[model samples]
Target: MILIAKIVSIDCNLKCDYCFYHRWNQNSNRLMSCGTLETLIKEGCDYSPICAQFIWHGGEPLLAGLKFFEKIIEFQNKYRKNGQNIVNKIQTNGTLINEEWAKFFHSNQFGVGISLDGPKNLHNTFRKYPDSDGSFDATWQGIQILRQNGIIPGIIAVINSANVIFPQEMFEFFIDSELKNLVFNPAMIKDDISGLPTGIVAKPTDYGNFINRIFDLWLKKDDPKIEIRQIKSVVHALIGGKYRSCRFKSECQKYPTIECNGDIFSCDGDEQNKNIRFGNIRQGLNHIFSSEIYKEYRRKIQRLRISCLDCQWYKICRGGCTRDYCSRSQELPKNYFCEGMKEVYQHISDSLKYYKILPL
Candidate 1:
């Protein structure tokens, strides 16, 4: 099980416009205490029979300071059971990465993912520091630093209004930057459980067009080393491989996310809902996993499974992420991006057939 620990809660250095956690009242000083961290590590080690991946997530995880991570490594060594593997990964804004941080990640074998939402103009449109200055320069510098340390950090670019319209440019930017490991997440607006859109939402067709353009470019590449996570997941699904991405899976994986205060939720999507809180790190995973609330959450997903059983792209789309459901009712809770997703999936399937990768 992957444990997504929000080590610093929602306290980020940059104020990104579409951040889901941006609405939270974050106390910058609030960080995961050593005591809380130790309990989490011990419980996590004991629970996972095989590999335990600890994903250090945050408003900005580095805000917890470098020393905080040193403690994490120390505790992992202390509590890990014999023959049990432990892995660490950090998702950061990349504005704070320096030589010291990059070297630390490289030394400890931590998977680093930096958020870069395209080139300066598009990226700076949303990702800005407290002083209202753009963060592209700092983030780009961080990527360079990581590369210099022989660490190729993965890039996470969010597809929003600013960047979704320029798919080819966005694809070329990543290719030109020599940062090929990419994950492009379409920006989604907040929707109530009853399936009502409450905020500005990106056009689903625009996102589909964006991915199609990128896919065409990628297909034409002499040596397509560019790895777009969403496209890769779709290709894997078409080839009869499991789509491991949480966004497209039929059933949501139970990856618990721990808040800075040690409060645990089944996943990041349930973070804001107080009713869905499983328990706290101090309460142990057994208590959290066994909680009635979590059970009910799992039960709710079954409806999606039933809803998508008849879908032509059921295997590839898997009803989309439950979190992306426009409605959470017992009735069909169609995916918010269903139309666009269908178009994209069909395009990919047709392309595969044309290439003779799949039987025509």
Candidate 2:
């Protein structure tokens, strides 16, 4: 479905090592009241087509409790002014997951995604509770419940520099587990410029290199159930097929993200970036287009940097997610990530000289 609405909740229990949100410090938001939800849905029904989705996202959505989510689903069930149909889904860290949440998911037809990195070490390296206790045991305990209940859990792993070299290990670890689907999102860091040091910036080529390594592993598998968002998007375009996407997929459309505190942004990538806020969720996403703050955000998306426009990778990367490229400024590029992509592409192309899986 194209028109999807995300119910955003801020404030998470876990504090990971490579947490960009913490680096940005945008997590001090509260619960979204029912009245705000009603107004937003009513406005969306006026603008969008019939097929719409209600995706619950958060610092930790389950932290809002199951009863709050139940109320949300109930609102979706009745919140129709025109032909808008809402399909409920949730992407959650499997901490508070229990039989109760699993049952609610099954009955509501919600697609469940769990945040799980590889084995305990790789996961604990970044993802852990605020108290610094490891979360693997509790997370897996919930996963086991979902498995027993016949609810398929989609896996989401954020790659840091350490695990970037081990695509085979990442895959084998997931394959050995019950996970049949996985999404790989590289770690995103911000420029610090805080006390004495600047933030750690992630280069585009480094991200590209990481993607290429995963592509290599994917080649080895006969029929991959793993669903990589970036490669799958490219493959969908190459094969002349269709694919599902959030607001981030297309350059033309700006997806709206509503925070629990009543702030709204163009998309999820702009979640913490201070420059993207446009009006309150009490108004509508339509306000984003009209608001002056969002105009620059849209402007940055439309006007490609001079160097990027001429680059060979532009067509494939589309400047590597507008929010990512412009998270710092409209002018500068993450030369590191871009160069890493080139290096990774060459490595893969060279490897293909000896081993060809997809017809070259």
Candidate 3:
């Protein structure tokens, strides 16, 4: 199971156009307290002593500062059970990272994920500071610092219409930047859920064509060091591996996110929807597991929608994200990216026939 700690609740340096936390009004002055951290660590240890992963997420987690993380490491050491292992990961907007931050991250063995939307031109289009100045230069500098410290940070790029048209350019940017690990998230615009003005959401056909072109580029590389998440996930699923993309997970609630105040949410994407909040750290895991929201989530997981079951890629996709379903209606609907995902999957499967990386 994964526990996402929204360490800083609401503070961020750059304002990315498609930021979900900002759109949902989830930002605040609230930050996780030491007592709350202790309680969370104890509860997590009790829940799974064998293995657990804690993802330090945020409005921008680094805003909590380096000392906060040092304390977290201390708490992890103090509470962790014998033979149990706890892995830590942080997802940040790369602007705050420096040599010291990189050193601490390296020494602590933290799996770092940086948000970079391709080249300067594309990245600056959406990711900017309060003054409306592009953060590309600062962010790129941070990425270079992390690399200098021997930390290969995973890159997460949100695909909006601005960058979606230039899939090849985006692909080459990552390759040229020497960024090997990457994930592209399609920007979602839901009027009912976000309560924000609709941004550029990629059309299914456009996204499919973009992915297909990138897949072709990915295949053509002779000694590929790059790992584009969407393609890699599809390839992994095709070969019958237990990959960890949430879209493919049978039960999304297994990975719950905890707010700075210790409020437990079913998932990060659904954090704004108060209806899905099961319980809090003080309530204990037993109480949370027995809550109505958790029970309902489990029920939904067990009973796959009829449309999803009929689809050929159902086993691999698992009907995609629950939040995507919640955006449209009360019932669990098929994935919003279903058509585009199918197109990418078919393209990869066809390409695999020639490479024969996995058994036929």
Top lDDT: which candidate number? 1
Off by over 4 Å in 2: 1-8, 23-29, 81-84, 194-207, 244-253, 290-292, 326-331, 343-360
Model 3 clash pairs are: none
In model 2, pairs of residues that clash are 191-199, 192-199, 203-337, 204-337, 204-338, 205-337, 205-338, 205-340, 205-341, 206-337
The TM-score ranking, best first, is 1, 3, 2
**For every model shown, what is its TM-score relative to the native structure?**
0.93, 0.83, 0.91
- Tens digits of lDDT, candidate 2, 1-360: 223334445567677766656544535656677787676656555555575666678777887777777787666667655666666667777988999988988888888989887888777767888788888888888898998888988888877765666667887888778576878766665555421112333345555666787777776675566677656655554344576343124352356676666677666654234446677866666765677777766675656444666876554445554444433444354333556655654555556555653356
**Per-model root-mean-square deviation over C-alphas:** 2.4, 3.8, 2.6
Query: Which residue pairs does candidate 1 place in steric collision?
Result: none
Best by TM-score: 1
Ranking by lDDT: 1, 3, 2
Per-residue C-alpha lDDT of model 1 across residues 160-244, encoded as one tens digit per residue: 8788889888888999888898898876656435444444455778778888888888888745677888888999989887556
Residue 81 in model 1: lDDT? 81
**Could you give me the TM-score of model 1 versus the true structure?**
0.93
lDDT of 3: 0.80
Q: Per-residue alpha-carbon lDDT of model 3 for 1-360, expressed as tens digits? A: 789988887668777776655554544566799889888888887888898688999888998889889998898898889999888999998898999999999999999999888899999998888678999999889998999999999999988878989988998889887887888877765564544325566776677788899888887775467888877778788888666587667677788889899998877764234457788989998789888879997776556445687788877777776654433345444456678878887888778876786546
At residue 114, candidate 2 shows an lDDT of: 90
- Compared with the true structure, all predictions reach lDDT values of 0.82, 0.64, 0.80
